[model samples]
Target: MKRISNLLIAFVAIEHILFLIMEMFLWQTPFVIQRFNMTEQIAKDSALLAMNQGLYNGFLAAGLIWSLLIRSYVEQAFKIKLFFLSCVVIAGIFGALTVKISILVIQALPALIGLVVVYLSKPQENYDVVI
Candidate 1:
């Protein structure tokens, strides 16, 4: 379980980095346009917009990184994870709704792992005894 949790965190970190690249660089490129089924003109016209969108994704990645650091805040960490996971879920839904290349598997895979980690890892409380 510990190993799986570590792997899950690592996987999400890498996935977010990839998203940073996709949004920051490839979003307006021919590759992205074709993959997302957007017009080449639109891609060319909205390079900055894509990068801006990528910044929000980067923020979520930053939050995940923070969560990994402070294990004491177990509930808070899970809440952060859920927030980002919800974003991914909504994005997947939008992609599906619009018939775009949603990449639902990739979006959901890390979230599923994180959710499992949270579900399986029990919190340890330190009780104070007055002397």
Candidate 2:
């Protein structure tokens, strides 16, 4: 269960890293334009904002990766993973509400699953503390 949880967390982190690349560096590319259904002018005009959003995604990815690196302290790792996964789920929901419904499936669903798995995989002794 721990291994599965970690894999899911890594998957979410990698997804965010890909998002960061797409939003920050490839926002104006033809593929991105087609994928986003945006006109060239719109893509050009919104590139900076997309870059900022991408940076935030990168931060989320970084936090999840940081949590993975804290191997010595299981409780600390659980807390960090929980926080970042929650953030991803919330961000995905917000994006879905404000931008597109697809965001819910694309961004939120995996993180939500990961969050649940991580919670379930927590050390038994740590169950006494609220997450």
* Worst ten in a row by lDDT for model 2: 122-131
List candidate 2 stretches off by more than 4 Å. Answer: 127-131
**Where in model 1 is the C-alpha error above 4 Å?**
72-75, 98-101, 126-131
TM-score per candidate, in order?
A: 0.72, 0.96
Give candidate 1's root-mean-square deviation (CA, Å).
Answer: 5.6
Candidate 2 displacement at residue 49 in angstroms: 0.2
> How far out, in Å, is residue 63 in model 1?
0.8
lDDT of 1 by residue, 20-59 (tens): 8998988877788887778988887877887887887787
| Model 1 clashing residue pairs (backbone) | none
Output the lDDT of residue 129, model 1: 20
The candidate that achieves the highest lDDT relative to the unseen native structure: 2
Against the hidden true structure, what lDDT does model 2 obtain?
0.95
Best-matching candidate per TM-score: 2
lDDT of 2 by residue, 1-131 (tens): 99999999999999999999999999999999999899999999999999999999999999999999999988889999999999999999999999989999999999999999999889766345455
Which 10-residue span in candidate 1 carries the lowest summed lDDT?
Answer: 122-131
